[model samples]
Target: MSSRSTYHHGDLRQAVLSAALDVIATEGPSALSLRDLARRAGVSHAAPAHHFKDRAGLLTAVATEGFDLLAAALAQAKDLKDAGVRYVRFATEHPAHFQVMFQPDLHRPDDPELLAAKERAGAGLRAGIAGVPADGRGPDARLAGVAAWSLAHGFATLLLSHNLAGPIGEQDPEEVFRTLAGLLFTSDTAQPPQE
Candidate 1:
């Protein structure tokens, strides 16, 4: 006597995940709940537990899913110079995942699925950075990655926070992302650290 969607029981896991993301998208991570997700997905209240042990388990799955999708997006960029834009695009497009992926306290970071997805995402970014001709090595590469990540993360965070929506207009987020990327590449001039 289950009330799960009859369209395709096979996609139930993905359906729940999708619904979870939708929930996160509107209410932020702290607001996510398995019961609500089940209701959103048109499934019996018990449905999500089959794929996720509990609410924490579901959030963990969402973070893992987010990392995997981020890996896919980074992989699609195909160039280091495109990394920032790709990063921003992923963040804006996958706000729910982006929101939870960085919150280490919300989900178990050592979860096998999360670890594996993290590595895949790291590899994708590494590959993307490799395309940068002047990209350096060691700490330089690490710093470069941090810088690019910061730029994209900062931009996407702003977008998610609704701070940038005012000025961005119709200029595709990519365009602003690209412009910022250009800013990153344009000059190395710096004054000094503030005391």
Candidate 2:
């Protein structure tokens, strides 16, 4: 098939991307295919190949888009606590994107757009760490930052996977996260338990 797009529909590229996301959300990423996406987007079978060389290229594009969205979420945070909450929110809101973004084997990590977006997201995470006040007694900022991220990411992962509902009891995930954030912000060294 020619590299040129065969789609005459409006925003065919975006439509395909949206369809890919829908498929990922419903059937998981393993079931995604260019022909399937084309059918979902109401485009020719070769149209997706024109926009994306293959499945990996399409996944790379999705990962890049995901990182851009994550960066935006982190940038909107008011402080470290807010950043943690936002991180969980982003993961929960974009489960399909979050899944593909972390699975490097599924996409081309060296792609220019992917690299830039990853850098932007990393910068946003680091900026949130920078906003926290330096603690006395030789607190390691890098360690603290990692710990903060681990807590939020772990919690979000558990919530998404339905592993937290039992422990969460009557409290929602966001409420539990808010309490956890308060503790982290108030303590000099706060780390969630490993289970």
Candidate 3:
């Protein structure tokens, strides 16, 4: 049987998405092409376009999937620190997704599904920091959430870029993130931050 006949109806979309992820993981998002993904998935060149419309549509789907995955990961965390570590873990684990999810220019920023997924991920991130008490002179809950996100994102980017290999020296990325979180966010759970 031909490879094109292997994919059932819905399977082709996922196969294409998976192929896109593989390409992004190996060569970065710039390497992704609908034609290339279709070839990788063993489907006709028009198959991917049918599902994704074009490259931006394909990337938008990838970003949406990434956010959904991130939201799920964040939802599993026990606390802010755990969430931060999980965020880093998600980035390292889904480097291609991570790379595309943040680059609005690469995907259709106005896409409804993408916007919703982004909100879900943002809500998950905010919920992670919701219980933490703000230092009297520190930021409000909103700012605290932003700070937490920045810290995790920066660390993840460094790790993905291999910039942490020297300073971290093979130390577990998650553990390093946990330690970093501890240093930054006090264990004491005083009153939660003001809105």
**Predicted candidate 3 versus true structure: per-residue lDDT over 1-195, tens digit per residue:** 465574444689899999999999999999988888887887777888888999999999999999999999999988999999889999989999999999999999999999999999998898888878755777888888888999999999999999999999978889989899888888685575689
The candidate that achieves the highest lDDT relative to the unseen native structure: 3
lDDT of 2 at 84: 84
Compared with the true structure, what per-residue lDDT tens digits does model 1 show for residues 1-195?
A: 344353246788898888888878887888878788877777777778888988788888989989998998888885765877788888888889999999989898889989999999998888765654452333466677777777878888998898887799777888888887877654333444589
* Model 2 agreement with the true structure over 1-195: per-residue lDDT tens digits: 333444677888899899999988888899999998998887789888888889999999999999999999999987788888898999999998988998999999999999999999888888778866664644577887888888998998898888987899778677789899787765355455589
Give per-residue lDDT, candidate 3, residue 58: 95
lDDT for residue 60 in candidate 3, whole number 0-100: 96
Off by over 4 Å in 2: 1-6, 136-139, 187-195
- Please identify model 3 stretches exceeding 4 Å from their true place: 1-10, 189-195
In TM-score terms, candidate 2 sits at: 0.88
* RMSD of each predicted structure: 4.7, 4.9, 3.8
Provide the TM-score for each candidate, comma-separated.
Answer: 0.83, 0.88, 0.91
Better of 1 and 2 by TM-score: 2
